[model samples]
Target: MTGFEFIAKAFKASYTDIAKRLNMTPSAIADWASGRRPIPKDKLPLVSKLFRIDEEYFKKKELTEVEKIKIEINYLERLSKRDTEQIPDTYTDDEGNQHETYFWYNPHEGELRYKYEELAYEELVLRIKRILTHDFALDMEYQRTRNHFHVVKELTELLDQDDGTVGIMEFEDISKEEAQRRRNLADRVNSISRMLYFLNGGKLHAFGKIDEFDEELFKLLRKFKIIDTKLPKKLKELDDPFDHRL
Candidate 1:
């Protein structure tokens, strides 16, 4: 976990909360998390004091396979405990853009208010973050499992030996359970790759890159994902409200 994540979860605070407490902008917090830039020297002390964490505690490090799996499982549990809401569509503008102001038939009011109000909509922001975090944790697990089985396969090839005797032995000496487990892991990696590709509109960029997280693009992807994952089920419910088989 990054320092930013640790602070947020431990404090039960949003990004804005951390930013306000540290006298920094929320985008700057996002940047630090994404590694667009490191924490400024001037602010590092304040952050350390605020979180009561030393440099060793906040330093960036790779998570182990067990840590990755734990993150994925914990997020999965959070996902299962939470319920999803189906939001109605926003209205379209004359310029073919969607706006909440269309609901009031006053685009000016919405335009003036949405930017500020959306920032303060803490629950909505948390919900979006929750889904994104879970998906990312799954991707991390897939990468971990793929690397493990790949090394296993490579090492197993070196075990091939030339012998004068013609006795038959199980080739490569991989246990039946291990072979089945490798196959299953491989299948999981493929399925996860495909799911991420489909959900992100096939952009197919690498995850966990040390680049800036474009907030606009993140919001766009979130909208696309919500529509993809929630719309079909919502439509099915509307068609048959009594059907309990989600």
Candidate 2:
């Protein structure tokens, strides 16, 4: 975990909550977590005080895998800045006319966002950093597991909301075919999760019923983590009807 993550965990707060307290954007917190941005000097004292730890606590820790990749990208950016390594600014268009253009590519999303103007060197560096750490190979698997976990969480809450007035139809937006597809996927995922849980000595699945699968389902959902595992846990604890579905 990063210092920012440790702080949020220790304080029982979300990134948005920490951002509000520190007067920074949530993306800034993500940058800190991703190691694209270091902790600001001005905020070190406050951070140390809040977490009841010394500044060196965060500094002395070994870099995580993500941070190591960020450091490599930063080093490569410096190397690419040499005078002999500059790229051209103009390209031949289909009309056979040379025109100025800039390109910024995000390998993770396979996207390029740019304007018909000069681009800042910082933009290229940022894109390279994203490309290096995107982990695209596992993106689909993670998203699929996350979707199943979401259904488990949402259905758990939905059971509590069925006071006989509201029907399940109110929350669905997809066609019946799509809904069946999702249901089949969810059943398969949930079955696999329960099997894993049973092997791991989790007793909640022994009950063998959907309504009784809450605790075991929560544990299984914990394994389907995304960028922030804590966020899902926090979302599960919320009581507001408007915020109950994850």
Candidate 3:
């Protein structure tokens, strides 16, 4: 599904046009498309934005039945288009094999963008249901500490105290049991927020962008009494346009 050919055809945008938009050479994009090289991390967002899709869409994942049907529908729609370029650019593969690659700038890119978004929402909703109902652990590993949930390889900078015990920021003088509870609360807030941020298929989160998911996010956090968790306050608040009150 990450194949550049599929992307070019599926988006109805030619590899040449995409490469031009990215200021990259056509052969380089072809290499990425052909899997001769893994897509450069630096260019991932650029490509994702150029296509109005999350970079996750370019990663290989098992598609749901509905997503497969979307793919099929897009394919059938492609079959109905008769305005594709008559002559295709010849693409040379890593094996020195030549292939014809057609260019199509149909009226389908906008439709494709929305379709990807719909798929993303479907995936997000499905994951939220599972995480809340069935998969209690969310399947991520963690370590129990007196002052932190201590997820493996994350949140390493827990505030160190004079007595060599970890603390969540300046809560070092709090009773040991209460300190542990606060730290656990902070960990849950951090962990779940991280989980929801990357949305699996939804948003292009992080990288210095305002997380529009916040209003609903923090509201959900209050369920477990994350009232004392230490996180940066948002500069401005967003109204939850949708009823995500849980």
Candidate 4:
């Protein structure tokens, strides 16, 4: 069966239901079914996971006639939903504009700090390292070189906070020293973390050149099949959430 149809039927969800889950409309789902619209790469992972199908199946150029037949049979076994909800809209601010921000509760710090932006997975990791290094340096509780180890621990705690989720950061006007301190701390943390990763015998090539780090990391991840197949299993075995690396 075609990957999309197979998944829809297996979930026992209608096209409408599938659309709602993917933040698409029922007609959009139908377009996918009819091959009228191309499936967006960003959504493919989510669709594969939701439908419990191999991601590679959806990456194929086209389905064979036999595959189409299998898909139809699967669809026949399921019933359509009577109602469906629209997906929520995701928005971004205009250039040079500011927006309201919110933050998760920091029990240890005893404060709620506003977030900056909705950071991607890689960005989130870097930001966590940045925050931890600043916190450590400011407290004078850790040696400069030992910041990485401390960062990993602090990050684990911060991520476990109830409000921890995919989010952004917001900044306010601050002294030059404060901003410089924050940047310096973030840079050190990032450097140390990379060194630690290499020391652990993990492949450092995945990180690519340190200059274009984020894009390189994402590209390396896409080149390897490790993330979709292996990382999830590793994540499940880890007791500490932050111990799982991207």
Which tens-of-lDDT digit does each residue in 24-52 have in candidate 1? 89998877765567778788788777755
The segments of candidate 4 whose C-alpha lies over 4 angstroms from its true place after superposition are: 61-246
In model 2, what is the error at residue 163, expressed in angstroms? 47
RMSD of every candidate to native, in Å, equals 26.3, 23.0, 23.1, 22.4
Relative to the true structure, candidate 1 reaches a TM of 0.26
Candidate achieving the largest TM-score? 3
| Candidate 4 C-alpha lDDT tens digits along 153-221 | 654444344555313222345457545754664575566465445434445345654345633443346
Candidate numbers sorted by lDDT from highest down? 3, 4, 2, 1
Residue pairs with backbone overlap in model 3: none
Error of 2 at 104 (Å): 61
lDDT of 3 by residue, 140-241 (tens): 433223113323123222211123322223533435754575466556545554544433323323436655465445444543544423333553234334
Tell me the whole-model lDDT of each prediction, alpha carbons only. Answer: 0.47, 0.48, 0.52, 0.50
lDDT of 1: 0.47
Candidate 2 runs further than 4 Å off: 60-246
lDDT of 1 at 193: 45
What TM-score would every model get versus the actual structure? 0.26, 0.24, 0.29, 0.25
Q: What lDDT does candidate 1 reach at residue 91?
A: 83
How many steric overlaps are in each model, in order? 0, 0, 0, 8
**Cα lDDT, model 2, residue 34:** 58
Cα error, residue 202 of model 4, in Å, equals 62
